[model samples]
Target: MNVRVMNAAVAKTVAPDKPAAAAPAHIAATGLAVDFPLEGRKQRVLNDINIAVPKGSFVSLIGPSGCGKSTLLKVMAGLVTPSEGTMTVAGLSPQEAVNARLIGLVFQEATLLPWKNAIENAAFLLMTADETIKKSEAFDRAAAMLKLVGLDGAEKKSPSQLSGGMRQRVAIARALALDPEVLLMDEPFGALDAITREEMSECLLDIWERTNKTIVLVTHSIDEAVFLSREVHVMGTGPARIIETLPITVPHPRTEESYSDPAFTAAENRLRSLLIESHKKGRR
Candidate 1:
C-alpha cells in the first residue's frame, strides 16, 4: 500500500474543476469551540474547529494530552455542548442523533460490570435503553455482537476473568450492539500492552470493515492513528484546534506486514513531524 499524504490546505484549494456530488457527511462541525470556567473566567479548550467525516469512513484525531481531541469527540457524541458554532451527526444535532441512537461511544476503560458476565454487560445498555426489549432478545443480540468482536465462547465469563484486550472487545461489542451509524472511540486501546494494542487495532479494522460504520478515533499514538485511520487529523493546543489533516492512503485489510510497508512508515513519520511541530507551538 502506497500512502499519499495530502495537505489539507492544498486539497481544499486544488479541488476538481467540476467537483462531483459528494455524499452528505456523517459527522460535521463548523467553527466549533468549547469553554470551561476557570477561576471565574472562561478557559477556551477548542477553537474554530471544523471537520467533515464522510459516511462509513475511518478517521482519527491525534494530539498531545489535553489538546481537546477527546473533547471534540465528546462534542460529536453529544456528551458536551460547544460554546460556539454547530455540529451535526448523521445530519442531525448531536443531541438529536443521540436520542435517535445514531451514535455510539467507547472510552479508554472497558467499564464492564463486575458481577455481570460478558453477555450481561454487553446487553446492559440495550436493556436499559429500551425497556420494551425482552431480556432473552437482548442477550441474543448481545451474543451476536460478542461473536462479531471475536468473543463467541466467552459469553459467560466475568470481567475479572477476561484480559484487558478481551474486556475492550466486550466494550466494543457493547457499543456495536446498538448498531449505531457512527462509532466514537477515545483511546480504546491505550491501556493495553504493545502487542495487544496492535492486535486490537487489527480487530477494530475488521469491525469497521464488517460494520462499515463511520469511526472517529482519538489517539495519542501516531502509529495507531496511521494504521487505523483513513485520515489523521492533527490538533494543536493553546486552545486546541485542528491544524492539519493527513490522508493515510494505505490499502485496507491491513495486516501486520502493512506496518513494515514504506507507506506506513511514511505516514507515521508525517504524523510524528506534525505532532512535534504542534508540541513546539504549544510550548511557546
Candidate 2:
C-alpha cells in the first residue's frame, strides 16, 4: 500500500481533506467527539479531537495531565463511545474490531495475572475460554516473545517475582501476541525507573522495527515520545487538542550517542518550546 494511504487511520473531528486520495486509508476517523455528564456535574472532558496514525508507523500523544490523553486512547481502543462522530478501527467500529481481536493494548501497569508464569502470562491473551492454542504452541510463542524482550530465562517466574520492568515487558509481549494492526499504549513506562524506562524504550523500538505494526502511544515524557516515535503529537494543555505534530527526521536506532546529535536536540527543543507555550496559554 502507498505510504500516504497506509497512514490514514485518524481519529474523528479531523478535517475531511484526505492525505492520499488515490489510495485511501486502511483505517480513519472523522468528527470524533467524546463527552459525558460527570454525574453531579456538567463538564466535558474531550471536545472535537482529530488525529491520523498511519499503518506501520509509530505515533505518540503527549500532553499535560487531565488533558484526556488516556481518554483519547480509550476512544481509539473503543472502550468509550463518542457522544458524536465516527471512528473506524480497520474499517470496523471499536467494539466490533476488539471483539474480532484486531487490537492490542498496553497499560501503565503490567496488569499480568499474578498466578501465571511469564510464558503463560505472555500467551494469556492468545487463549480464549472456548478456544485456546495448545500449551506447547503457547509456550513456544511466549518464549519467542520473551526472548524478543530479553526475558528468556525468566519464563517460569510468576508476576510477583518479576521486577516492574520485567512485568511491563511481559505486558508488551502479551499485547504483541495478538498481532494487532494498531497497538494502543497508555503510559506503558510511566511507572518504571528512568533506567528501566530507557531500556524499555530501546526494546520497544526494536520490536516496532521487527513487527512494523502501527502504534499510538500516550506518554508524558517528551523525550520518550521523541525517542520512541516517528511523529509526536503534542496537545494543548487542556481542552486537549493537537497543537503540533513534530516529525522526527533523526534516523531510528537512535542511541545514547545520537542524543547529542543536532537533529534530535532540535526536535526536542521545538517540542519543548511548543509545550511550554501551550502550558502558559492554559494557565492564562
Candidate 3:
C-alpha cells in the first residue's frame, strides 16, 4: 500500500478509525531483552530487539526455534517480564491493555473446552476476574467471527468433535469475541497438515480484512510468513536480535494466485536467504 506514499489521504481519513483508535499505533516494542534462569546461570533469549507494529498492519515474527520468537511474543503479551526494554499494546503496557481487554492471544493449540460448545468456549473469557469478554454478547460476536473465518456452521460443535483446522478456527473466534485491538498468534497453524495450514492461513487473512485487527504472528516457515504478513520480522539466535524487517508489499485479501506471483516468490526467497544466513551463523 506504500503506506508512506498514501500519507496525505490516509492521514486525513483512511488510517484513522480503521482499527481500534484514530490511527493509533497498534503495538510497539523497543529494546526488548528477555533472560531466564537456566542451570543456575542467567540465559539471555532476546537482546536489543526493537519493532513497531502500525495500526491495522499484519506482521510475522520468523526465527529459529529457541531464538526467542515466542519469548518476545510473551513479553508483548505480558505473560513474561522482559529483562530489559519496553512493549506496548496501543501505547499501553501489555498487562494493562490485557486487563482492559485490548490484547487477544491465539495459542498454538486450540485450548478450547472439550465440554463446552463453540459459543460457550468463546464466552468463557468473560468469566475471567481481571478482564471480561462479556459472555452475554460474546456468543453472537463469536459466531460472527466464526463466519468471518469461514466456519459459520461449526459453532454448535465442541472442540472434541471438530477437526484440527476447525478447532483452530473456533479458537480464533474465541480470541475475536472480545473485539481485541491486537491479535497475538503463536504459530497457530504449526500443528496442522500442509494443505490445512494453507487453508487456515487464507482464513486468517479473511478475518484480518473484515475486522482490521492488528496481528503479530510467529512462525518458522518462510512461505507462511511471506504469504500472510505485510511485514516480516526475521530474527537471529544466541541472544536473539532482529536480522531483518522486510516489508511484504502485497496488499490484503491475497489470492491463491498471489501465492504464485513473482513478488511473493521473491519475498519468500529473500526471507529464505536470511534464514539460511542465520543458520550459517550457528543459529537455528
Scored by lDDT, model 2 comes in at 0.78
* The candidate that achieves the highest lDDT relative to the unseen native structure: 1
Query: In order, what lDDT does every prediction score?
Result: 0.87, 0.78, 0.79
- Model 2: CA > 4 A from native: 1-27, 40-42
lDDT of 1: 0.87
lDDT of 1 by residue, 1-284 (tens): 01123443354221211111266678888888999899999999999888888898898999998899999999998999999999999889999998888888899999999999999999988787788998999899999999999999999999999999999999999999888899999999999999999989999999999999999999999889989988888888887887777778788779888898788998888778778977887889
Off by over 4 Å in 3: 1-24, 129-135
- TM-score of decoy 3: 0.88
The C-alpha TM-scores of every prediction are 0.93, 0.88, 0.88
Sort all candidates by lDDT, best to worst. 1, 3, 2
Q: Residue 225 CA error for candidate 2 (Å)?
A: 0.5
lDDT of 1 at 252: 72
Question: Which candidate has the top score in TM-score?
Answer: 1
Give lDDT tens digits, candidate 2, residues 193-262. Answer: 9999999999998899998888889999988898888777777745665655667777867887767778
Residues 1-284 of candidate 3 have per-residue lDDT tens digits of 23224333322222211232234567877777888999999999888877878888898999878778998889888899878888888888989987888888998899998899877786666556334445556677767777877777777888888899988888888788768888999999999999999999888887888888999999988888988898788887865787667778665569898888887888887778768877777533
